[model samples]
Target chain A: MASNIPEKYKTLIKNNKRIDGRTLDELRPVKIKVGVIPSADGSAYIEIGNTKVLAAVHGPKEMFPRHMINEDRAVLNVRYAMLPFSTSERVRPGPSRRSNEISKVTRHALESVIFLEEYPGMGIDLTLDIIQADAGTRATAITAASVALAHAGIPMKGLVAATAIGKINDRLAVDLNGPEDNFGQTDMPIAMISTNKNITLLQMDGDFSKEEFKTALSMAKKAIEPLFEAQRAALQKYYK
Target chain B: MTLLYQNMQYIRNNIAKNREDGRTSEQFRDITIETGIIGRAEGSARVKIGDTEIIAGVKMEIGTPFPDSPGEGIIMVNSEFSALASPDFENGPPREDSIELSRVVDRGIRESKTVDVEKLCIEKGSKVWMVFVDITIVNHDGNLIDAAGIGAITALLTAQIPTINEDGTLNREEFVGSLPIKEIPVPITSGLINNTIITDMTKDETECSDAIFTVTTIENENYCAMQKAGPSEMTEKQMLDIANIAQKESKKIRSAIKATVKKHKI
Candidate 1:
């Protein structure tokens, strides 16, 4: 069989340890800081492993152009972009198909928690810019955006936490890093509201048996707890 | 306003009984697949589920592979929601909705390894066959994702690889064997409306839906891709329940597709 495996690494897992030297289910160190940007209404910065992202929330203000306004509830606009130097190969500085898809899913991930109905005929804008990417950038972006929204004092039902789960070298792992994501058999990014364990966003690609899928979902639930706590801590620290 | 409420009430009542079209909650709409619809294209298929219609065409060309995967060929999917498909569609560049649709369909095919891309590599890093699938929404009744996905795979299944002369001249009239297809993946979408999980949602039902989930399954009932959309949150129980429904429904759809391809002698 022709393999797309990178030649740099022989195997992703050895002796129940990942190439990054973490256990199968261990998450990379996460650091979150809120109110990072003074010019914006609210902003936050986060780093998970090598992936760094900044998220900013703009407004629950007037809906521009009038036609896009929703009388029953406010409209949400999200933009996700990776900087030119974010990856090893310099990415083009513009919205790409991948970025567009990520923006839409990220908006859906945050929409359920925000009280859009309170500001009818208004619009809330959010932007997530990836400063550095290893893997799981979407999950990192979602986590940062949640904290930024909360920092803006936007009323939300609960915080949303996200992470990626994957299978590498015939074993399931949580919070896949760069190499694991590239050569792994599966990558499933999931976002959840931790209070009630409601899933807000989910997207998966690659091979997975039904049983493996169930296991991945449970692993995602477990992986999200620390992220949820990190978000809460960031918000609490800022408010204090 | 009164009319809208009454219509919603009627839909709710129908869901309580059967569906508006008299199908069960988990039942899918009637599916129709027609292959080789676009004669000029390398391969093409038109698929319809109930009133939703989509046309997918495949075009192959010689191009250099990406730097990361120089040994494998490339497959790119693009979707267009023309104004003719629905009143809401506008004449402009691709919107986020259409981009999402294309990516979701592309994931199902790419993740399943439906096309043996390595076989299309003519040289180690110099040249490779670039397969492009363009999906157009002809009618938007509902569940365009499933319809478009089916159309794309059906088109690819019937595609023929073109022969290239040693001097790098193109020969469109002559053909090598069929494209290398390893597996077929079927995407099934389920919508949550009024706490009721319904498959094959119609346009009216989709407008009122709280959330939608799509799961793509291949042979052996393994899930290769999935996407959860809409603005509502779903409990774990609901997500898993939808996945089960997708798995069951995909089997029927796969068999139908296989039968259709067999009848066409492709």
Candidate 2:
């Protein structure tokens, strides 16, 4: 079967370079801002490469419909929408099949750090809107959402940051762009609480040797330093 | 919704004149249509009618032809009534309302022969194309059928099938061509409240409606599908009037679809 691996990418990989002219460990520029939406309890905006995401944290308030309510711990609900104008072709407005599954994982990622027991019978809602998407939009949204949650003054274990690292044309590259994501051999989008060294979220597809996986994970680990700093800076900027 | 229900007499009087939001009984809500929005999908559009927003996405994959139609491609429509869109919606599997909505829209497109399904065939029965059109409700104000129908048709019109790899995976990076289409179908809906007929009911207005009807026409030339809901009965004259109005209203909607699709041609 012909994989998405194009000859140009493979050729570039052989030369120890990437299509975007970055070294193996190089990253795209990242911008993060907190408290973008005044109506929400807390909000954030982030841009990773061409992917732009906005996240709002709504209430650690009452969980409704009776059944979803938890007596001992607050629930987390994450809804990720790729806006119709967010891509080259318009996405339909509602959640696709992947949307629900991603919500579950995103909830788990945020749940680990949140002091859910403090707000029993309530739900913290996170809404992520991808205003412009390239690839790895979910990770970018999670990174921004974490910042928004912190800005809301929700107690937490630590702030989180998300990024993806993968192999493109046999070259392990940090932060795959739209094209790289389509053609890369393997991709792992992950979330980590910066201080605990714990992997809060992990999912991977495509082929990766054990050695390659370790390298990708470690590369992701290193990328967090900058992402965590950006998150902190955004929060600090909001306070100042 | 209780606000409209609580003032039942006012709703009856309002629909007899202008709607609650002041649109004439025959007028539709303000609509903004744009196409080519989702990058990963074959075709996509975002449509907003008043406060009701919906997204339509079309994606194509190669699959076996259904047993009954070995020579034709398949088109499937799925509507998701998101819980976040409205307080009434739920967050799990599709509810009966969404299922009915999808089926009605699917029948309109299929019966109108909007897409030339035969052209989608790759091989006799071994391989053919399947088009998935998903309409997701972003915000539910009311009159979801019309909004979803508009979204479905616009996305399909703008969709392009992805190039197939030699061994049959897809080249997500490139396109083969636009899906084969013959015509576009536009759906128009009307509701009755306090014996007064109204078009495009908002969630609040829906509470006061006694009967609801939806009709879809193709290029203003023919009726392709129609559906009626509510506990009330419609007089023959009322149904005829609805048919006429829906057909006439479809003209404006079809032109909008064409212009939007034309503006963002692949």
Candidate 3:
């Protein structure tokens, strides 16, 4: 019934292109700043196009209350918080189902690359707070979390990065912005470890052909390469 | 209610200046309104009064009309005050502050008959348009009632109604016209501090006040809504003064709204 509703959005993001003039397979310009918070062991501020998020890591410490210890490996704690003034519509300050789900999946995405055995029975806390949101928040949260973990000197095989591939007007587009994500038919967010190209996170909704899925996955793999480079450069810049 | 002896003394001594910042008792804080800021809503505006900020959005939908008012559309007002705005505010369902704000805003719009609901009726007694106005407090310096009211009305004034298809389905991408608003309602709030009445109370001023008064006017002369809050007593003369000041101040705010609509070409 709302099929005719997204025509403006479709015209804005024509086939193989986005509203901001980027090609379908291209990623948004990402900037990452490491060690932004001196209070946290590790912290990173990241911006993917217009979306901005901050991640902080505090870890390898005894689990609070004592009984929640894992005994086998360090526990990963993830939290996603959006500032009340982050989006155009003020969001109530608290964790909603969306944030809870993002926090859980974000932990899973980073868990695959983290060397948890190095800090047995300790706690590793990661907080991803959104300062400004345009779209693709979960993907940027994972990207910043991975960078914050590396900055914290946590043991990890490789840094992780994420991006979204969405279908708009029957076209596969990478890094959907706010309007595109809202109007588009399908949205898929993917997270991967850059070193070995292992897909640690994958999620999608809406219509997609088998061919579209393969093309989107390959595009995500290639899109994360430059993101991986940006991650390393952020840490390197801080060290210097 | 927190009228400490020292603060009370300060307010008495500063009576000549109207406030610590030297604004006249009837003067309002700086007003700034930016429309169409929310991408998801049909109509949206972010308004700021000095340091206090609020955002308002209007969402339109089609639903069955009320049994008695089948030909008239519905307008629902709601508000939120998150902890981010102030430590005193909690995150949950609507609190007393939010409910009061919404009710006051809603009363003014309803009493003024701003939107011509009869025009909103898509089908005589079965289908009608519903307009929802949501106001969110971003910063709580003070006078949230006025800030939210302005935000809501501004958003509504700028809101566009989507085109209805032949089958009555809404075409979200294409908006046909602005909501059928009949009039503009502007609100001004005043508070009593140290026995003196003040307009546009700041957070500090509101914290120590005994009574608060708000008046909403339409076309600069008609009273649409009025509210009195807090535990302090209000003299008959004080209430009359509030009404007078509100009537005078509303003209300026209404002009501002008109300028905004003109600038936005809505």
lDDT of 2: 0.80
Candidate 3 residues B1-266, lDDT tens each?
A: 33576986787667656587788887788999999898778898899999999999999999988765767888999888978998778799775557767877887787677888888888878888999999999998988988888888899998999888988788877898899987888878998877788899887788867667777888837565666565333444566677778878888988998898778754
Report the C-alpha displacement of residue B266, candidate 1, in angstroms.
Answer: 6.4
Q: What share of the true interface contacts does each candidate keep?
A: 0.85, 0.00, 0.00
Compared with the true structure, what per-residue lDDT tens digits does model 1 show for residues A4-61? 6667655988899999999999999999999999978889999999999999998888
lDDT of 1 by residue, B1-266 (tens): 11276787778666757777878889888899999888777888999999999999998899999887888999998999999988878889999889999999999999999899989999989899999999999999989999999999999988878889888977767789788998989999998887789998988888778789999999989999999999999888888899999899899988888888777653
Query: Pick by lDDT: which candidate is best?
Result: 1
Index of the highest-DockQ prediction: 1
> Per-model C-alpha lDDT, please?
0.90, 0.80, 0.81
Q: Give the TM-score of candidate 1.
A: 0.96
RMSD of each: 1.9, 20.0, 21.9
After superposing candidate 1 on the true structure, give the runs of residues whose Cα lies further than 4 Å from its correct spot.
Answer: B1-6, B9-14
Error of 2 at B222 (Å): 1.2
Instruction: Quote the lDDT for B135 in model 2.
Output: 95
Estimate TM-scores for all models. 0.96, 0.53, 0.51
Model 2 segments beyond 4 Å from truth?
Answer: A1-240, B1-4
Candidate 2 reaches a DockQ of: 0.01
**Clash pairs, model 2 backbone:** A89-B37, A89-B38, A90-B36, A90-B37, A90-B38, A91-B37, A91-B38, A93-B55
